[model samples]
Target: MKASNGTTQDVGGRRKNSKREDESGRLGEYGQDSSVNGTKQIGATSADSSGENIIRTSVTWDGRSDAGKILEEVLLLKQQFLDYVKSHQGRLEARLDESKKQEQKFLANAEGLELRLRKALTIQQTKDESDNTEEPE
Candidate 1:
Protein backbone atom coordinates (compact mmCIF):
# COMPACT_ATOMS: atom_id res chain seq x y z
CA MET A 1 0.00 0.00 0.00
CA LYS A 2 1.30 3.43 -0.97
CA ALA A 3 1.32 6.32 1.47
CA SER A 4 -1.57 8.81 1.58
CA ASN A 5 0.17 11.10 -0.92
CA GLY A 6 -2.71 10.34 -3.37
CA THR A 7 -0.61 8.07 -5.60
CA THR A 8 -0.87 4.36 -6.46
CA GLN A 9 0.81 2.06 -8.95
CA ASP A 10 -0.50 -1.09 -10.62
CA VAL A 11 1.17 -4.16 -12.18
CA GLY A 12 1.16 -2.57 -15.64
CA GLY A 13 2.95 0.56 -14.38
CA ARG A 14 -0.37 2.40 -14.40
CA ARG A 15 -1.60 4.90 -11.75
CA LYS A 16 -5.02 3.80 -10.39
CA ASN A 17 -5.57 6.44 -7.68
CA SER A 18 -8.72 8.21 -8.86
CA LYS A 19 -9.99 10.08 -5.82
CA ARG A 20 -10.87 13.67 -5.13
CA GLU A 21 -8.53 15.53 -2.80
CA ASP A 22 -9.74 16.01 0.78
CA GLU A 23 -9.31 19.68 1.57
CA SER A 24 -9.46 19.05 5.33
CA GLY A 25 -5.78 17.93 5.44
CA ARG A 26 -6.67 14.38 6.51
CA LEU A 27 -3.11 13.06 6.05
CA GLY A 28 -3.37 10.21 8.60
CA GLU A 29 -1.51 10.75 11.90
CA TYR A 30 -1.46 14.52 12.57
CA GLY A 31 -0.70 14.63 16.33
CA GLN A 32 2.78 13.18 15.93
CA ASP A 33 4.53 16.46 16.89
CA SER A 34 2.26 18.30 19.29
CA SER A 35 5.01 19.29 21.73
CA VAL A 36 7.58 20.52 19.24
CA ASN A 37 4.84 22.06 17.01
CA GLY A 38 3.57 24.79 19.36
CA THR A 39 0.31 25.32 17.45
CA LYS A 40 -3.43 25.73 17.97
CA GLN A 41 -6.66 25.59 15.98
CA ILE A 42 -9.46 27.97 16.85
CA GLY A 43 -12.97 27.96 15.41
CA ALA A 44 -16.36 29.42 16.27
CA THR A 45 -19.88 28.80 15.00
CA SER A 46 -23.41 30.13 15.28
CA ALA A 47 -26.90 28.69 15.41
CA ASP A 48 -27.42 29.06 11.69
CA SER A 49 -24.06 27.60 10.82
CA SER A 50 -23.84 24.67 8.40
CA GLY A 51 -21.17 22.13 7.51
CA GLU A 52 -20.49 19.59 10.24
CA ASN A 53 -16.81 19.36 9.36
CA ILE A 54 -14.52 20.95 11.93
CA ILE A 55 -12.45 23.73 10.50
CA ARG A 56 -9.18 22.74 12.14
CA THR A 57 -5.43 22.83 11.54
CA SER A 58 -2.15 23.07 13.38
CA VAL A 59 -0.50 26.48 13.71
CA THR A 60 3.24 26.83 14.41
CA TRP A 61 4.31 29.73 16.58
CA ASP A 62 8.13 29.46 16.21
CA GLY A 63 9.01 26.80 13.58
CA ARG A 64 7.05 23.82 12.19
CA SER A 65 6.51 21.63 9.17
CA ASP A 66 4.63 22.25 5.91
CA ALA A 67 1.34 21.35 7.60
CA GLY A 68 2.00 23.97 10.23
CA LYS A 69 2.61 26.57 7.57
CA ILE A 70 -0.71 25.72 5.91
CA LEU A 71 -2.48 26.08 9.26
CA GLU A 72 -0.89 29.48 9.75
CA GLU A 73 -2.35 30.58 6.43
CA VAL A 74 -5.77 29.41 7.57
CA LEU A 75 -5.50 31.45 10.73
CA LEU A 76 -4.57 34.53 8.77
CA LEU A 77 -7.60 34.07 6.54
CA LYS A 78 -9.88 33.76 9.57
CA GLN A 79 -8.54 37.03 10.97
CA GLN A 80 -9.14 38.77 7.67
CA PHE A 81 -12.73 37.52 7.58
CA LEU A 82 -13.37 38.84 11.08
CA ASP A 83 -11.97 42.23 10.15
CA TYR A 84 -14.23 42.39 7.12
CA VAL A 85 -17.29 41.54 9.22
CA LYS A 86 -16.48 44.27 11.72
CA SER A 87 -16.12 46.84 8.95
CA HIS A 88 -19.43 45.82 7.44
CA GLN A 89 -21.19 46.06 10.80
CA GLY A 90 -19.88 49.61 11.27
CA ARG A 91 -21.18 50.65 7.85
CA LEU A 92 -24.59 49.15 8.59
CA GLU A 93 -24.87 51.08 11.86
CA ALA A 94 -24.02 54.33 10.11
CA ARG A 95 -26.70 53.69 7.52
CA LEU A 96 -29.27 52.96 10.21
CA ASP A 97 -28.46 56.24 11.99
CA GLU A 98 -28.84 58.20 8.78
CA SER A 99 -32.22 56.57 8.09
CA LYS A 100 -33.48 57.43 11.58
CA LYS A 101 -32.47 61.05 11.14
CA GLN A 102 -34.34 61.23 7.86
CA GLU A 103 -37.43 59.69 9.44
CA GLN A 104 -37.39 62.23 12.29
CA LYS A 105 -37.12 65.13 9.86
CA PHE A 106 -40.06 63.85 7.83
CA LEU A 107 -42.22 63.50 10.95
CA ALA A 108 -41.42 67.06 12.05
CA ASN A 109 -42.30 68.47 8.64
CA ALA A 110 -45.58 66.54 8.61
CA GLU A 111 -46.56 67.86 12.04
CA GLY A 112 -45.87 71.46 10.98
CA LEU A 113 -47.98 71.03 7.85
CA GLU A 114 -50.86 69.60 9.87
CA LEU A 115 -50.78 72.56 12.29
CA ARG A 116 -50.89 75.05 9.42
CA LEU A 117 -53.85 73.28 7.81
CA ARG A 118 -55.82 73.28 11.08
CA LYS A 119 -55.23 77.00 11.60
CA ALA A 120 -56.43 77.84 8.07
CA LEU A 121 -59.63 75.86 8.58
CA THR A 122 -60.34 77.63 11.85
CA ILE A 123 -59.92 81.07 10.17
CA GLN A 124 -62.25 80.15 7.32
CA GLN A 125 -64.98 79.00 9.75
CA THR A 126 -64.74 82.28 11.75
CA LYS A 127 -65.15 84.34 8.56
CA ASP A 128 -68.25 82.36 7.53
CA GLU A 129 -69.91 82.91 10.97
CA SER A 130 -69.19 86.65 10.94
CA ASP A 131 -70.72 87.05 7.43
CA ASN A 132 -73.91 85.28 8.54
CA THR A 133 -74.22 87.47 11.67
CA GLU A 134 -74.03 90.81 9.75
CA GLU A 135 -77.37 92.74 9.46
CA PRO A 136 -78.88 93.05 5.96
CA GLU A 137 -80.08 96.42 4.57
Candidate 2:
Protein backbone atom coordinates (compact mmCIF):
# COMPACT_ATOMS: atom_id res chain seq x y z
CA MET A 1 0.00 0.00 0.00
CA LYS A 2 1.12 3.51 -0.72
CA ALA A 3 0.86 6.06 2.08
CA SER A 4 0.17 9.71 1.55
CA ASN A 5 3.83 10.42 2.14
CA GLY A 6 4.70 8.31 -0.94
CA THR A 7 6.06 5.44 1.16
CA THR A 8 5.26 1.88 0.05
CA GLN A 9 4.26 -0.72 2.59
CA ASP A 10 3.22 -4.36 2.29
CA VAL A 11 -0.44 -4.43 3.22
CA GLY A 12 -1.12 -7.84 1.71
CA GLY A 13 -0.13 -9.50 5.00
CA ARG A 14 2.27 -11.95 3.46
CA ARG A 15 5.53 -13.45 4.63
CA LYS A 16 8.61 -13.32 2.44
CA ASN A 17 10.25 -16.74 1.94
CA SER A 18 13.41 -15.74 0.04
CA LYS A 19 14.99 -12.82 -1.83
CA ARG A 20 13.77 -13.01 -5.43
CA GLU A 21 13.87 -10.71 -8.46
CA ASP A 22 10.49 -9.03 -8.85
CA GLU A 23 8.97 -7.96 -12.17
CA SER A 24 10.89 -4.68 -11.89
CA GLY A 25 14.17 -6.59 -11.33
CA ARG A 26 14.34 -5.54 -7.72
CA LEU A 27 16.21 -8.09 -5.54
CA GLY A 28 14.01 -7.59 -2.48
CA GLU A 29 11.41 -9.67 -0.63
CA TYR A 30 8.90 -6.80 -0.62
CA GLY A 31 6.56 -8.64 -2.97
CA GLN A 32 3.46 -10.42 -1.70
CA ASP A 33 3.60 -14.23 -1.71
CA SER A 34 0.34 -15.99 -2.49
CA SER A 35 1.31 -19.05 -0.56
CA VAL A 36 1.22 -17.10 2.73
CA ASN A 37 -2.20 -16.53 4.25
CA GLY A 38 -3.06 -12.97 5.06
CA THR A 39 -4.50 -13.95 8.45
CA LYS A 40 -1.53 -16.17 9.42
CA GLN A 41 1.36 -13.99 8.25
CA ILE A 42 3.36 -12.27 10.98
CA GLY A 43 6.25 -9.80 10.99
CA ALA A 44 9.45 -10.54 9.06
CA THR A 45 10.33 -14.09 9.93
CA SER A 46 12.46 -14.17 13.05
CA ALA A 47 15.52 -16.41 13.36
CA ASP A 48 13.42 -18.83 15.46
CA SER A 49 10.50 -18.92 12.90
CA SER A 50 7.87 -18.99 15.62
CA GLY A 51 5.05 -18.94 13.00
CA GLU A 52 3.51 -15.94 14.70
CA ASN A 53 1.97 -13.12 12.66
CA ILE A 54 2.62 -9.58 14.00
CA ILE A 55 0.01 -7.59 12.21
CA ARG A 56 0.20 -3.86 12.68
CA THR A 57 -3.31 -2.58 12.16
CA SER A 58 -2.49 1.01 13.01
CA VAL A 59 -0.07 3.61 11.68
CA THR A 60 1.99 5.87 13.94
CA TRP A 61 1.88 9.57 12.95
CA ASP A 62 4.74 11.93 13.71
CA GLY A 63 2.89 15.21 12.99
CA ARG A 64 3.65 14.94 9.24
CA SER A 65 0.59 12.95 8.37
CA ASP A 66 -2.47 14.10 6.39
CA ALA A 67 -4.43 14.71 9.58
CA GLY A 68 -1.65 16.93 10.91
CA LYS A 69 -1.67 18.96 7.73
CA ILE A 70 -5.42 19.36 7.92
CA LEU A 71 -5.12 20.54 11.51
CA GLU A 72 -2.56 23.12 10.48
CA GLU A 73 -4.84 24.35 7.73
CA VAL A 74 -7.74 24.68 10.15
CA LEU A 75 -5.61 26.69 12.55
CA LEU A 76 -4.52 28.99 9.77
CA LEU A 77 -8.11 29.53 8.73
CA LYS A 78 -9.09 30.32 12.30
CA GLN A 79 -6.36 32.92 12.51
CA GLN A 80 -7.47 34.42 9.24
CA PHE A 81 -11.04 34.63 10.47
CA LEU A 82 -9.88 36.36 13.65
CA ASP A 83 -7.86 38.82 11.66
CA TYR A 84 -10.81 39.61 9.42
CA VAL A 85 -13.01 40.23 12.41
CA LYS A 86 -10.42 42.54 13.94
CA SER A 87 -10.11 44.51 10.75
CA HIS A 88 -13.86 44.94 10.48
CA GLN A 89 -14.01 46.01 14.08
CA GLY A 90 -11.46 48.73 13.45
CA ARG A 91 -13.39 49.99 10.44
CA LEU A 92 -16.63 50.01 12.38
CA GLU A 93 -15.00 52.01 15.17
CA ALA A 94 -13.73 54.56 12.71
CA ARG A 95 -17.12 54.89 11.08
CA LEU A 96 -18.74 55.38 14.48
CA ASP A 97 -16.25 58.12 15.30
CA GLU A 98 -16.96 59.86 11.99
CA SER A 99 -20.70 59.66 12.59
CA LYS A 100 -20.30 61.21 16.03
CA LYS A 101 -18.28 64.07 14.58
CA GLN A 102 -20.98 64.74 11.96
CA GLU A 103 -23.70 64.68 14.60
CA GLN A 104 -21.82 67.24 16.71
CA LYS A 105 -21.41 69.47 13.70
CA PHE A 106 -25.09 69.28 12.88
CA LEU A 107 -26.06 70.05 16.45
CA ALA A 108 -23.79 73.10 16.49
CA ASN A 109 -25.32 74.37 13.27
CA ALA A 110 -28.84 73.93 14.62
CA GLU A 111 -27.92 75.85 17.80
CA GLY A 112 -26.48 78.70 15.76
CA LEU A 113 -29.63 78.92 13.63
CA GLU A 114 -31.80 78.96 16.75
CA LEU A 115 -29.74 81.87 18.19
CA ARG A 116 -30.06 83.83 14.96
CA LEU A 117 -33.85 83.29 14.84
CA ARG A 118 -34.22 84.46 18.48
CA LYS A 119 -32.23 87.66 17.77
CA ALA A 120 -34.36 88.44 14.71
CA LEU A 121 -37.57 87.95 16.73
CA THR A 122 -36.29 90.36 19.44
CA ILE A 123 -35.45 93.05 16.86
CA GLN A 124 -38.89 92.81 15.26
CA GLN A 125 -40.60 93.13 18.68
CA THR A 126 -38.56 96.29 19.55
CA LYS A 127 -39.36 97.90 16.21
CA ASP A 128 -43.12 97.23 16.66
CA GLU A 129 -43.04 98.77 20.20
CA SER A 130 -41.28 101.94 18.94
CA ASP A 131 -43.77 102.36 16.10
CA ASN A 132 -46.72 101.97 18.49
CA THR A 133 -45.35 104.69 20.88
CA GLU A 134 -44.87 107.32 18.06
CA GLU A 135 -47.48 110.20 17.58
CA PRO A 136 -49.43 110.22 14.28
CA GLU A 137 -49.07 113.36 12.05
Candidate 3:
Protein backbone atom coordinates (compact mmCIF):
# COMPACT_ATOMS: atom_id res chain seq x y z
CA MET A 1 0.00 0.00 0.00
CA LYS A 2 1.08 3.61 -0.51
CA ALA A 3 0.67 6.70 1.64
CA SER A 4 -1.26 9.88 0.68
CA ASN A 5 2.01 11.25 -0.69
CA GLY A 6 3.66 9.29 -3.57
CA THR A 7 5.84 7.29 -1.08
CA THR A 8 5.13 3.49 -1.11
CA GLN A 9 5.95 2.21 2.35
CA ASP A 10 7.04 -1.47 2.10
CA VAL A 11 6.00 -4.24 4.53
CA GLY A 12 9.27 -3.70 6.49
CA GLY A 13 8.73 0.04 7.03
CA ARG A 14 11.06 0.97 4.09
CA ARG A 15 9.72 3.91 2.09
CA LYS A 16 9.91 3.61 -1.74
CA ASN A 17 8.84 6.33 -4.18
CA SER A 18 6.06 5.34 -6.64
CA LYS A 19 3.11 6.73 -8.61
CA ARG A 20 -0.10 7.06 -6.45
CA GLU A 21 -3.29 6.04 -8.23
CA ASP A 22 -6.78 5.60 -6.71
CA GLU A 23 -8.97 2.58 -7.49
CA SER A 24 -10.70 4.48 -10.30
CA GLY A 25 -7.48 6.24 -11.49
CA ARG A 26 -8.14 9.20 -9.22
CA LEU A 27 -4.99 10.85 -7.90
CA GLY A 28 -6.29 11.36 -4.32
CA GLU A 29 -8.01 8.90 -1.92
CA TYR A 30 -7.74 5.19 -2.92
CA GLY A 31 -11.30 3.99 -2.32
CA GLN A 32 -14.82 4.08 -3.71
CA ASP A 33 -16.56 7.33 -4.50
CA SER A 34 -18.77 9.25 -2.08
CA SER A 35 -21.81 8.21 -4.15
CA VAL A 36 -22.62 4.96 -6.01
CA ASN A 37 -24.99 4.43 -8.93
CA GLY A 38 -25.97 8.14 -9.00
CA THR A 39 -27.33 7.90 -5.44
CA LYS A 40 -25.99 8.74 -2.01
CA GLN A 41 -24.62 5.77 -0.05
CA ILE A 42 -24.78 5.21 3.67
CA GLY A 43 -22.59 2.62 5.34
CA ALA A 44 -24.44 1.53 8.46
CA THR A 45 -22.87 -0.79 11.02
CA SER A 46 -24.66 -3.84 12.43
CA ALA A 47 -25.66 -2.07 15.61
CA ASP A 48 -26.85 0.98 13.64
CA SER A 49 -28.86 -1.14 11.21
CA SER A 50 -30.45 -3.02 14.08
CA GLY A 51 -32.41 0.11 14.94
CA GLU A 52 -32.52 1.54 11.44
CA ASN A 53 -36.27 1.71 11.45
CA ILE A 54 -36.30 3.78 14.61
CA ILE A 55 -33.46 6.04 13.42
CA ARG A 56 -35.13 6.70 10.10
CA THR A 57 -38.43 7.44 11.70
CA SER A 58 -36.86 9.79 14.19
CA VAL A 59 -34.90 11.65 11.55
CA THR A 60 -37.88 11.93 9.24
CA TRP A 61 -40.35 13.00 11.88
CA ASP A 62 -38.25 15.43 13.85
CA GLY A 63 -34.96 15.91 12.00
CA ARG A 64 -32.73 14.57 14.83
CA SER A 65 -34.09 16.77 17.59
CA ASP A 66 -33.66 15.89 21.26
CA ALA A 67 -37.40 16.11 21.79
CA GLY A 68 -37.90 13.61 18.99
CA LYS A 69 -35.64 11.07 20.68
CA ILE A 70 -37.43 11.64 23.96
CA LEU A 71 -40.74 11.17 22.21
CA GLU A 72 -39.65 7.81 20.85
CA GLU A 73 -38.51 6.63 24.27
CA VAL A 74 -41.73 7.84 25.83
CA LEU A 75 -43.77 5.97 23.25
CA LEU A 76 -41.87 2.77 24.03
CA LEU A 77 -42.40 3.24 27.75
CA LYS A 78 -46.08 3.94 27.23
CA GLN A 79 -46.47 0.75 25.23
CA GLN A 80 -44.80 -1.27 27.99
CA PHE A 81 -47.00 0.35 30.61
CA LEU A 82 -50.09 -0.43 28.56
CA ASP A 83 -49.07 -4.04 28.18
CA TYR A 84 -48.50 -4.37 31.91
CA VAL A 85 -51.87 -2.80 32.67
CA LYS A 86 -53.61 -5.17 30.30
CA SER A 87 -52.01 -8.20 31.88
CA HIS A 88 -52.79 -7.07 35.41
CA GLN A 89 -56.34 -6.20 34.43
CA GLY A 90 -56.89 -9.70 33.11
CA ARG A 91 -55.60 -11.24 36.33
CA LEU A 92 -57.66 -8.84 38.45
CA GLU A 93 -60.82 -9.67 36.52
CA ALA A 94 -60.28 -13.37 36.99
CA ARG A 95 -59.74 -12.93 40.72
CA LEU A 96 -62.85 -10.80 41.01
CA ASP A 97 -64.92 -13.46 39.27
CA GLU A 98 -63.57 -16.10 41.61
CA SER A 99 -64.41 -13.99 44.65
CA LYS A 100 -67.95 -13.42 43.36
CA LYS A 101 -68.49 -17.15 42.94
CA GLN A 102 -67.23 -17.82 46.43
CA GLU A 103 -69.56 -15.17 47.86
CA GLN A 104 -72.53 -16.69 46.04
CA LYS A 105 -71.70 -20.13 47.42
CA PHE A 106 -71.54 -18.72 50.96
CA LEU A 107 -74.87 -16.94 50.50
CA ALA A 108 -76.52 -20.11 49.21
CA ASN A 109 -75.18 -22.07 52.20
CA ALA A 110 -76.57 -19.42 54.61
CA GLU A 111 -79.99 -19.62 53.00
CA GLY A 112 -79.97 -23.43 53.25
CA LEU A 113 -79.11 -23.22 56.98
CA GLU A 114 -81.93 -20.71 57.57
CA LEU A 115 -84.41 -23.07 55.94
CA ARG A 116 -83.25 -25.97 58.14
CA LEU A 117 -83.61 -23.87 61.30
CA ARG A 118 -87.18 -22.98 60.38
CA LYS A 119 -88.03 -26.63 59.83
CA ALA A 120 -86.53 -27.60 63.21
CA LEU A 121 -88.58 -24.94 64.98
CA THR A 122 -91.84 -26.25 63.40
CA ILE A 123 -91.04 -29.84 64.44
CA GLN A 124 -90.37 -28.80 68.05
CA GLN A 125 -93.66 -26.91 68.24
CA THR A 126 -95.62 -29.96 67.03
CA LYS A 127 -93.88 -32.24 69.60
CA ASP A 128 -94.65 -29.79 72.45
CA GLU A 129 -98.34 -29.61 71.48
CA SER A 130 -98.64 -33.42 71.50
CA ASP A 131 -96.94 -33.72 74.90
CA ASN A 132 -99.27 -31.03 76.41
CA THR A 133 -102.39 -32.80 75.03
CA GLU A 134 -101.41 -36.21 76.47
CA GLU A 135 -103.01 -37.18 79.90
CA PRO A 136 -100.80 -37.57 82.99
CA GLU A 137 -99.96 -41.09 84.20
Please, what are the lDDT tens digits per residue for candidate 2 over residues 40-118? 4545557536554534423555555799777899999999999999999999999999999999999999999999999
At residue 128, candidate 3 shows an lDDT of 94
**Per-model TM-score versus the true fold:** 0.49, 0.50, 0.48
Give the higher-lDDT candidate: 2 or 3. 3
lDDT tens digits, residues 66-102, model 3? 8877889999999999999999999999999999999
Candidate 2: C-alpha RMSD after superposition: 21.8
Ranking by lDDT: 3, 2, 1
| Better-scoring candidate (TM-score), 1 or 2 | 2
Best-to-worst ranking by TM-score: 2, 1, 3
lDDT of 3: 0.81
For model 1, which pairs clash? none
Once superposed on the true structure, which residue ranges of model 2 sit more than 4 Å away at CA? Answer: 1-65, 135-137
Clashes of 1: 0
Please report how far candidate 3 places residue 101 from its true position, in Å.
Answer: 0.4
lDDT of 1 by residue, 1-137 (tens): 44456886543544588675655567545433333356643335364345555444223344545777788999999999999999999999999999999999999999999999999999999999899889585
Q: How far is candidate 3 from the true structure (C-alpha RMSD, Å)?
A: 18.8
| Model 3 TM-score (2 dp) | 0.48
Question: Which parts of model 1 have CA positions greater than 4 angstroms off?
Answer: 1-65, 135-137
